[model samples]
Target: MTLMRQETEEIPAAVARLLSSAPETIAPVAAAFRAFDPHVVVTIARGSSDHAAYFLKYAIELVLGLPVASQGPSIASIFGAPMKMGHAAALAVSQSGASADIVAMAKTARAGGALTAALVNTVPSPLADSCAYTLDIAAGEEQAVAATKSYVNSIVAGLSLIAYWANDKPLKTALANLPEQLEKAEALDWSFMLETVSNAQSLYTLGRGPTMAIAAEAALKCKETSVLHAEAYSSAEMLHGPVSLVNRDFPVIAFAARDAAEDSIVEIINGVIPKNPHCYISSDKSADAIQLPFIATGHPLTDALALIVPFYRFVEQLSLHRGLDPDKPAALKKVTVTR
Candidate 1:
């Protein structure tokens, strides 16, 4: 059994841990958000953590109507440039919480008059030390070079904070039931899409709204573990120039949440069916595309996180099928510190 597979199965328990500890761990962050009430929000992260930030970007903007943006850590880590972030809030995410660039960016956000917080696995690490509040994702120690439980927990932490801050009863209720939903997600089989891409050199992942981050994370995992080149695009964006590459047999995985975007995403997937026969989509609604199984977390936001669990399981198997080790990808490290 590879570490990646082990960690992927641990996602439900990890999420349960984060949820059970939310009252104490996330209360202060929610309180700070209510009190600070910043005009804008900014996120600092890299790689998988950055995809978690993108998920939060959509949640914050859609739920609270506060505009959110991502700040490149290189600005502070390399150029030593100052930013005008007064009256803003910053959210930084890292599993290890030791990246110098992320730490520097968090420090810069604080110095620029922002209320900064972090979601990290290691509670007392440098990035956590630099923030006003740090919520431990509580994913335990992930041994896989490709992150699974940590990424899911990071988004859960962010969504929990958003739920409390916005006082969204539906979202809060959905989050309370998330552990079970995530467990259901783990059992879903995406092997049809896996078999389709098992021999392909490249593929395209499509999604809209918060699930776009799921698509992005899925694409990254394909590259990291399966050694396949996968590109992520919004269902709308893929119709532009990217679809030109799609032939009758080109593989495409569309992540369609059971939210407002579901109909549109299904429509787009149906549109692609003429050009690509290997298109697989995850949604309850049917289309010309192949239907991949998914769990419908009661709330739209939590639905996004649920989709990744099955994908993680699929990617782990796909990697092994491609003669690669999912536990250790090529040219990668567990903790990457960039400055």
Candidate 2:
């Protein structure tokens, strides 16, 4: 815990402890919504959680085939019209479970007859209060100003819901092994990311499976810690229009996983590496073939494990490479409040 805590002041050791909470421990949460066949899902969150929402949305849709949208705080705060509420269930993701505007939005969705849920670290919070179901991240107390364990845990929890809801056997098995994979990812060397990302003007993180959310998480780390202009996209989406522009000038980060989409995603990576040539890769396998395990999420825990490892290292190292303190980010705080 000290090794995890020493890197950032606001981040406490207890928060990192949440990483090991078994998903099966929260099996009751998955059981609670067994009856719900939501037409769509709308996620309400801020900053880091919002980014996690993006990845979760992609994962749920890719596997469950249910439409999912992440509401902008402004959209839910000012519009007053509940779009996600009309036909979909609402999932509010927060570490604090106290963001005023997102809570308000989730309440609005609940009042509109849509089912509601909260993925949170805090118990007895406004966000949890508003939803009928609460999927506790059980990440315990997050001590770091920058969210590490809770954010990853929330993504894992959400993926569990998606996997269970879809009831895809192979996908479920892959996700179940995620926790071990994450541990492996944590041990992988990431010194190269610091050396490489410093000189790049722009970077891209690409993924397809639940790892698409991993790409988004990676991009957030790049910007928050290093001030790099980084963006994430689905591997297929990157090849659609953005891929044409990828060349030697850009460094591409691929979030590869053991999902059905791996082959096509690998193909997309093949296409980009030849063009951009500055490819950074993360996985839960031997570092021999790819760039090595950049983070811990590549371990058996699929989404959850990957959530902890690759992006955390990316952010931590990017901070070191730039001589910036990871403890306090530029113009950011432990909790974000919206109007």
Candidate 3:
């Protein structure tokens, strides 16, 4: 058990390198899409890729306030068959670039007069061919059945796309500084979490604002790495019914921001804490927990993207410590199929 020696440290470093890769890897794309001021954005993918795409939609709309939607079979499958993509930006998110449905949607997006882009881990997949512009994540070969490297890489790549589109100098600077923060976070100890969260059979995470999208990533990483069942809900949605799950043993992670709503968000955390379940909180402003200095959309998304690395390291270590093979969780595969 040399746990620290595992790929834990390399995870953040590799993701950092991938984030900076966009300047060089996607320069051609930068030149290609300079003219299109796309209004409607639609995304297509499956599993983790799709999850990252949802995060992207939120990021783009949140910062730019442009409308974005996830393109389903109605517009995607019909293609030129009476139903059209209708002047929207289409993003095909795929790890392998082999998913035909994603490829077709990218083409349909182009056909419908919307500029299309491919956010992918693989450089030369079919999905890339359909999109006029592409950002290659360069995550390398992800050997695990559930994604680790590729998921973070995808988030970074998506951030780069939004940053580039907005010509955001602050975003570029923030991303440059994000890697070191993640390195520091990875090296830190999380012994408290193992005793508090590892053995738990179920967990819940909540976030609002930009963190609302980040919650999805946190939930996915929790499941993939530790195999502890976890669910993510928008902060508002949790009050609807999910709040009833609170108990002393269950762990809850609340994501709050340093904003006008900070008081309300903290109140929510306080309300959840007395429910007795162990709780962890994260914010760029918090003094006690992991602080990424969430710098709005620019550096924060990059930092938020890095947020998963520490959790991954903790969960992966817990998996091995518990005599479970994290590389192969039962009944799960890297790529899933659906009809």
Candidate 4:
């Protein structure tokens, strides 16, 4: 088996480990967040980590009712601008905790008076040092360049932190049950997408709210592992302009979690099925679009997060089917440090 496939299978256990040790690692960060009580939250990350931030952004906004923004690392690393973050809190998500610019931005956020925290797999790395609070995501050594477990664990860490901060029992219960759900998620069959993805040159992924972030991550994984060109769009935004790109030959996968937006997503999928018959959706509510089985995590937020596991499994198989190596994508390293 490929390293990517092995790592993908390991995700359930990784998340379980992270959740089991949450009190020792994540609780302190949650305490800090509760104490700070910032007016706004800003996230610092890139690539898959950035996608995790996007997921957390919706979670923070919907649950805590605090607006979250993505802060550009270049503000400190390139332009060297002084940020006024006195009323803000910063969350930096990194798998390696070694990116130079991410480290710089974390330092800048702390200096600028934001209650800075980091969720990282690498415990003693520079990015962790830069932040006032650091929670190791505890995904273990992720050898695959595509980052299956680390990405999942990063989001899990952030969600756990949020749950502790708000004392949200329901969210906590959902998280406690996430490991079993994730195991089922890993076992799900998404092989139907392999033939379509292998044949197609390009496709679109659609989601709303937290699932939009999952869609973005899915698109990136397609590009990274299979060398396929894929783009992610919000179901709402696709109607505006990108819907013009959808045709009979074009494939679309809409990720609809069991949330307030599920009905709207199903409607969007129904609208697209006429123009593109090769469409798939995660939610079973869609009658026309091909339904992809998903593990419902009870909470809307975690239900979105669970969608990625099967995608990871499918993409790994797709990469191998295309005679490509999922672990070592062309021109991509495991740990990218960009300034």
Candidate 5:
């Protein structure tokens, strides 16, 4: 078995380990967030870790009503620009806490008086040391260069901290049940997409709200594992310009969680079906598009996060189908330290 597949299979257990250690690892950061109560939140990350931060950006905005923005590491590392982060809080997500640019930005945020925190797998690394607070994601050593469990656990860790900070009981309950839901998600067969994706050189992924982040991650996995070209677009934005790219041969996958955006996603999928017959969606509400099975995690936040596990499983097989190595993608390293 490929290391990517093995790490993908270990997602549920990795998340469970993160949740089990939440009180000791994540609660303090939550307490700091509550006390700081910044008007804005800024996220610092890149690649898959940036996708995790994107997921948390929605969660923070939706639940806490605080505006979240992505801070480019280059602003600090490359251009040496100082940021006015005194009234903001910063969260940095990374699997390896060794990225020079990420660590530099974290230090800049801290020096500017932001309540800075890090969600990282490597505990004592530079990024962790640069932050005022650190929550170890506890995803263990991820061997796959494509990054399966570490990405999931980074979002899970951020969600746990958000749950604690907002004192959201319903979200906490949903997170408590997420590991089991992830197991069910991992068992689901997305092979329904294997043939379609394997035949196509490029495709589109669609989602709304929190699931938009999932769509972004899905598109990245397609590029990293199968060497396929994929772009993610919000369902709300699909009809504007990107929909013109759709044709009979083009494949589309829309990820819709059991949230307010489901109906809108279904409508968008139905609209695309006439232009392209090879459209598939995760929700059962769609009329003509093929429906992919999804495990509903009983909360909108977690429901969005759960969709990635099955996609991870599918993309691993898709890489093997294309006679590519998912574990060792071309021109990529396990830990990317960019400055």
Candidate 6:
């Protein structure tokens, strides 16, 4: 088996380990968040880790009613700009904790008076050392060039911290039951949509709110592992210009969770169904397009994360079918240290 597939299967266990150690690993960060009570939150990350931060963006905004923004690492690493974040908090998500630009930006956020925390797999790396609170994802060694467990664990750790900080009972309960839900998610067969996109050279992935981040992560994995050209856009954003690219044979996948945004996403999928017969969607609601099975985690946040596991399984097989190695994508490394 490819290391990517093996690591993808390890997602549930990795998340459970992080959840089991939450008190020791995440409580202090939650305490810090409560004390800071910042007016704004900034996220620092890149690649798959950036997608985790994007998921947290909706969670923090909707649950905590605080605005969240993503900061480009180049602002500090290249422009050497000064930031006024004295009334804000920063969350840096990194698997390796070794990226020079990410570490530099975290240091900059700290110097500017933001209470900075890092969710990282490596405990004693530079990014962790630079932050005031370092929450280890506890994902262990990830061998594949395409990340699986680390990406899932990063969001799990972030959600755990958010649940504790916001004191949201629903989100906390959903997170507590997430391991079982994730296992069910893994067992789902997303091959229903595979036959549509496996042979296509390019496709479009659609989602809104938190699940848009999942779509973005999925699109990145498709390119890295399978070399398929995929693009992700918000359900609302797609209709503006991107929808023009859709045709009967063009594959479209819509990621809709059991959240308030489900109907809106489904509407987009239904509207496009007549033009594009290859469209597929995931939701409890019935739509004209093909419906993909999804495990509802009882909360919007957890449901969003759960949608990705089955997609991961599908993409791994798709990569193999396309004569590609998901474990060793060309011109990529496990830890990308860029400035």
What local lDDT does model 4 show for residue 97? 96
What lDDT is reached at residue 302 by model 2? 58
**Residue 4, candidate 2: alpha-carbon lDDT:** 28
Cα-based lDDT for every prediction:
0.92, 0.68, 0.68, 0.93, 0.93, 0.91
Per-residue C-alpha lDDT of model 4 across residues 124-200, encoded as one tens digit per residue: 99999999998999999999999889999999999999999999999999999999999999999999877877988
For each candidate, what TM-score against the reference? 0.98, 0.82, 0.85, 0.99, 0.99, 0.98
Per-residue lDDT tens digits for candidate 3, residues 1-339, read 333235455666766777766777765564555456665778887777877887787778766677878877335554434335545677888888876667766776787777788888777878888887887877776667666667667767777777776777777777667667667767655556776677678888777755666577678767765677889987777778888987877788776654444456555666776675476766543344333323332354554555556666666777776677777777877655332
**lDDT, model 1, position 336:** 95
Can you give the lDDT of residue 329 in candidate 5?
93
Candidate no. 4 TM-score: 0.99
TM-score of model 3 vs. true structure: 0.85
Which stretches of model 1 miss by more than 4 angstroms?
Answer: none
Model 3 clash count equals 3
State how far residue 25 of model 1 sits from its true place (Å).
1.5
lDDT for model 6 comes to 0.91
The reply for model 4, stretches above 4 Å from the true place, is: none
**Comparison by lDDT, 5 against 6, better one:** 5
Q: Residue 6 of candidate 5: its Cα lDDT? A: 93
State the lDDT of candidate 2 residue by residue for 263-288, as single tens digits.
66667776666676577655444232
